[model samples]
Target: MTTSTTDSSTPAPGAAASTDERIAVVNPATGLQIGSAPVFDAAAVAELAARGRAAQPGWEAMGFDGRALVLRRMQQWMSDHADELLEILQAETGRVFEDSVLELAYPLTALGHWARNAEKYLRPQKAAASSPFVLSRRLRSYYRPYGLVGIIAPWNFPITIGFGDSIPALAAGNAVILKPSEITPLSIEVIRRGLEECGMPEGVFQIATGAGATGAAVVDVVDMVMFTGSTATGRKVGAQAAQRLIPASLELGGKDPMIVLADANLERAANLAVFGATVNSGQVCLSTERFYVEEAVYDEFVSRVVAKVSALRQGVPVAPGSVDVGAIITADQLEVIDAQVRDAVAKGARVLVGGQPVRGVTGRFYEPTVLVDVDHTMACMTDETFGPLLPIMKVADADEAVRLANDTRYGLAATIVTRDRARGAELAGRIDAGTVSVNDMLTHCFALGLPMGGVKTSGIGTRHGAAGIRKFCATKAVLVAPSFPNADIHFYPANEKVSPLLLAAVTGLYGTASRVARATPRALATARRLRRELGR
Candidate 1:
């Protein structure tokens, strides 16, 4: 694929030359030329910002209903055009068509749900007034939009992560400026313009096509930012957002773990383990980066997993009803995966199964590789390879599995394949992650009810559940006085007695609730005796 040339030379559509048209766009799956996504220069960026600023007012005025209607219909259109979306996604990112839909479809589906329920969710709720004397008063809390939001999205699962990250901000009434990766820009436009056609006002959903520089500009200017990418870039975005104190929700990186318990259904776990580690060519934030298997079942599990990995269909992911294990998004990413695999081998790690790419001239395809004897010290074990590379290690039991799982600086998501639901939940609780799946890998994301985010280096804040849907708006507290004399209790000299009395009353209740519940036997007996004596 060759990049289509477009004029991004003029800034503001009227200024002198700004960005010289740059770079060709190559289709990842087939290496064919697709149309170009313009790389905006400073002038074009100014225009985009200006348009976004202009659109914000009309969009905000749409209130909740109008915006919801548009999003609701947009969700329908997305469902209807699911095939087209899958095709575009596969072409642009080398993700298998089925996995592509799995990633994109659900997040887009969330649009309708968010639109329908966001009004209630985003609206302010009543908070305690605290002072009982002013019980007649009313207080409520609500959120406000963060104006413009900057989104820097990655190429892997481009549509899913991209839309999932931005939709909440839009629902919250913030104008969004999206920066899709240089590698997968076309699909983003498909997304950007889709919202446009859904009748979302211009500027409200402004799309600026560019690479890192354009992305940096958004960080320099917008109200808040949501980013999904490598840990390195996430750190940079975090730093930039912090420098401006512009509050960012970062889905940085993950070395997510998947555990197979001794009690786990070895068949199911093996099947999922192979599919989970290699889905999207393992270029997934939540993919199983590390596998911990109980010693009793370790050998059998490893054997079955290797056999399944060897069975994955590695090829061009676009043919009809193709058996698909997706390709890595780029040659550079291919190199990264290759180096990690080669290094691991050199450093005494054994490749239990496939290591090199299969016979193909298509996209960046790598055979599903399984590695054993991997320790935490190796970069392959610690960092995200974002390819179909699974490193397995043996553990004595589930306890050790849990320890090894939590042993990373990153904890975006984890999956455990065990038949014991209660044990899975218990283990999940002990695990430090935003989302955990029992008996499957990456399936939890399909659950709209589940919130998606991470702990440690995974990310800050959340998305996908109620917390995510509500993060788009500004929460504000409103208080109204009872218009009575006691409402002015804080006026000080107006009521010295009342202030202390009220303070004591509130403090005493709080103290009694928290401190007196487990009072010493002596104290309880004394109180009982005193109560009896007083009654007499």
Candidate 2:
């Protein structure tokens, strides 16, 4: 909504803000104006979309190997200029060095992974015919890129979510238009420069930097949209994409739960709880927002978590090792965090560590907090507290834990900690979340081979694995009939003789008891063989 910038201000060189209207970029860590990005209205987004469309054919013509060459070089560019990138990221997002380091690391792996794996993942497949009628025909499917894609990235983890997602889209042979969050648009300018230095074709990848309006414009213009943000915003984007008949892949909010069993390693679980919930100032969608601990070890787990949280240093992140927790990205978000904590306290939740914003700080920072005696009625337990807050609840058993974990509308991810990993995994299956980690937390996001996304209100579609790259593509099925008769029996005229033959064939293949009787023994034998092999 704040769309105007000072006339005296100069735009960042090579920034995509071609228009006079600009969105001022502020350093959440310092509470200062760092830079500004152009406010691209609907017309500007359309123009950029057209440029991307023009460049797409050339990029697509380059083929997978050619794109990989550019992407690999970009990876090298990131390594060479890591400090500059990280500084920009830290300034804009207010993430601590360690958290920012992880943010940068993701894109490095993503660039290489998508570059190397895109072709293999999207390669044409020879699909087997499902019916006897099509047995003579060769059925194959191939993926083709959408000409242009728009990525609406969130303010948190701008580099990882902003550019990381674009890697697969670009590798899939689509030109990408990235609309980074207005809160942290500066870092993306640096990334855009790196891509150019890496010899990526001009206009093949462009940044449309502005606020929500710009993001909406991008959704309106591009062939497909991939959005990562809050669930409420995701729903709007999804609706817009639906209206245009474009596919939308949204990775939205999460109130991810962590369940610690009675037999769990309290030390490891506590360590992860502190790290998972406090990292990125607990702004991650995958952050463990609430905990459902088995009653037997609840006291010990809470004590350990409180100790670790109390030790965290919250302040402005000026440099590496300066603080364990950095400032919240905006005052609005800080207020949200404060309100949630206060609401929890009002509802009889006791804050064991921190319950208020850090005092005497120029920038917004909330102390790493641990809450116990929390329940489903509390905001901290129900709503997404995307801040440095962890609320732990004692559940009678794993069944109750699973029930409480699945009770929320969010189903992004959940974690289970137990010495018996088999039982942990069994409990994980019962938790209704897209990703369930046994004896671990947040590490599943790094397993690029596995698809990650959410269900229910959290998100639709996924990122990573085959789906990540393929979602940028449109699949085509090709069927070839080889050595076909001049006039097939099933072809034109309603032949009475052909009808009976077809009926007999269908009945014999599917409906007949004789067919089932003949196949039963073999099926049983195969099942027995599988069981024996699995036992071995």
Candidate 3:
């Protein structure tokens, strides 16, 4: 996790062209460029993609065990250099040190999960046909690598989200080109260096840094694209991949909700709600944005939320005594947050806690806001407000809670806090989300064994677990017969005897069991006549 200052002339291994134009990677807290990233032109991206394609076969030849060894090396490298990586993450994203540290575990976890399971997941599996005719034939599906992959990552959690998809893609044996968010390319570069140090082949994993054009280039050139960002941008990415007719997996916007039942632990529920809403300053896709509390415990829940939020400390990303919140990413994002808050207040929503930007913070900082009396008409309740704003609305009962939770267009995740495990499980089945957490917020996401993805506008395809690795592969069915010399009864001739017998056999196999009993005798007699006529 070290930074290197490069001039326009000296291009890094897979960096963009040497244009005078550059993107400055700024530290949000200090409002200064920590490092400048190259703006890759179309040509540079093409060359990078070509290099990745050329290097893929050799890497693929490494096999699952070989790739797993490399992944383990990367994990050990990150562990050995955890402190330095944390410093770079904090400097680039302005996230609290604890939050950044928490994200670091995901990469190692993903790498380990894939390394441990890739062979089993991708191995050829028998898809035995149930029909009696094909019972003796061998039919299996083998997972084939997609050759090359392009990843467009968001800036929210640079280390985790930026390179998360790449781990499984590499494990599945495809070369990858990562187009990290221009704002936070530093951590990605740190990852690139670790891969290099682990003795991974050149061009197997590359980074192309720039804005939208760079990402577009990646989508255009690669065989597959995995994008993590806003829904609007994901649509554009999907369209681009559509032009090439290549596959894409998108992890997009989320307006996640939290449902509080009356029987739940009020204190635990409120504490988790505050953490879920404000974690990473609410930049996370799965961060709980809406709260639906049962009327019986609504007031108590709101009170607990205000108390917890009030005690949250905000400052530089990395400081002593555990900073709870960090600076917002940029000025434009801050403006969006402000506008949403203003709109909600104007529409009769009541702000229960801090609602404006923090009074004395030097950099991009917004106070953790809590809103009550919020209705669906308010933008803060419906749209994605990627700031530290928690909106609580009362529900008459569990029915209303579930209804309000599923009312959104996005269904990435939902949380239910309940003491009744059976009741919670039942309600979880009804919630139209990719993941429903019972008495928890984001624990499911970290559980790499379970697949994670979104429904509707949230995302396409899943990440982590076995599905994550398999998504990067194309399943090819392989079928084999005992012998090709022995021709079938339906080979070519339109014989009078075989035709009616074939129909009877079809009817017998597909129709009722009684029909099979009646048809079998005639079909066998026809087969004897046909065999004698064929000179056998």
Candidate 4:
């Protein structure tokens, strides 16, 4: 990875000078060049992978305790340098200060969580045999590291998703090569430097900074791959990993829905809907994109949502509280947001608040938008609109709300809002998503003990909890028999007497009630035959 530096002559954001082998980094809010990173080719990535492979053994040999120490130090380092890290995050992604703070805070929690729990989660476990025939045998299982792991992170939450995912892979004793999205790659470099300062061994954790080809190279060289991106890109990554026969875990696209029942607190439901849909400029995979509210309260809910969205402060994030919402991460994303809003309007949806890009702003930004009269026929309701656009549809009842919620191909997450907790939870269970939050939204992702992942086109496999760390490992099962006869009855003498005894013993152990009592005598006779065969 090249060191970040500002150059006035460098091309604007999104313009990579491939001939010069560099990707120009830009501050999305200002649309100005912030720095440039080397566009590493396949050969460079292979060399980095080789170095990581060589260092992995030593890192793994350090044991969980040693690794945890380094991780703990990193936590302190992050705390000490939170402001500096937050700055890089803000500059590259153009997210609000509060959103950037989340990107910083998540890794701190993840570092501590994975450091403290990895050994316990990956520890060997004794297995019990189900059959009486294997009672004398001991069975155990343990995990082994995959040696090297590749993580391809999207641009939205560079630190939270990129470094956060690496924590568990590192804890599981694997070397990590993170290929952060070129759009927002600067923040990860800061993390790599912090890890080195915290006594992380060289080559154990490295960043491969470049575009899609760079990510592909990392996937080609690593033992396993974890990807966070669009469903289209995830499919390619999944296919590549499959061709290599390596394990792949994907966190893909989502068109998360919010269901508001008639019994819901209208104020609270509307507040959550606006925040969940517009936070981080609505770039989150788990963000609520579409809403289904009970028709009885639909007009009131839409009114409240529009009021809140209109009150939002959209601007460049200069500091904490500088803006309630920040610039869109890329120009391309701005277009997507505009296109979706237009498509919804064309399909007879009414824009209750914002409906287009903010004017008089040099930075790429979309207005925090709210739409009513939306249905499954509109792209904004059915497709992934990863921007600050919320389109709500009226449902006749909870059943209709559920039907609309499950209407999407993406099943990453969904939210239910109701005053009756039990009813909300029941409806949550019926929603087809990997995670369903009742009376809440987007908070389940922070609970490190709970697993998070998408289902269907949203993603495959999971992150967090035991599945997170264990996915970076290979399981080994060990079975031992402490005692055995010199020539076991089943082992090779081809004895007719031994076969008859074995059959009788099996009959006594598992036969029906009618024959069980009578088979005991036959079992006793078999025991005598076994003793004679053993020369006892």
Best by TM-score: 3
Q: What is the lDDT of residue 297 in candidate 1?
A: 95
lDDT of 4 by residue, 323-371 (tens): 8998888888899899988998998999888898988867898999988
Once superposed on the true structure, which residue ranges of model 2 sit more than 4 Å away at CA?
1-18, 513-536
lDDT of all predictions: 0.76, 0.85, 0.85, 0.86
Residue-wise lDDT of candidate 3 within 368-398, one digit each (tens)?
Answer: 9999889899888888878899999999999
TM-score of each: 0.88, 0.92, 0.94, 0.93
Q: Which model is ahead, 1 or 4, in terms of TM-score?
A: 4
Judged by whole-model lDDT over C-alpha atoms, candidate 2 comes out at 0.85
Residue 65, model 3, lDDT: 97
Error of 3 at 109 (Å): 1.0
lDDT of 2 at 274: 92
Q: Which pairs clash in model 2?
A: none
Task: Compare candidates 2 and 4 on TM-score and give the better one.
Answer: 4
Which should have the higher lDDT, number 1 or number 2?
2
lDDT of 3 at 170: 94
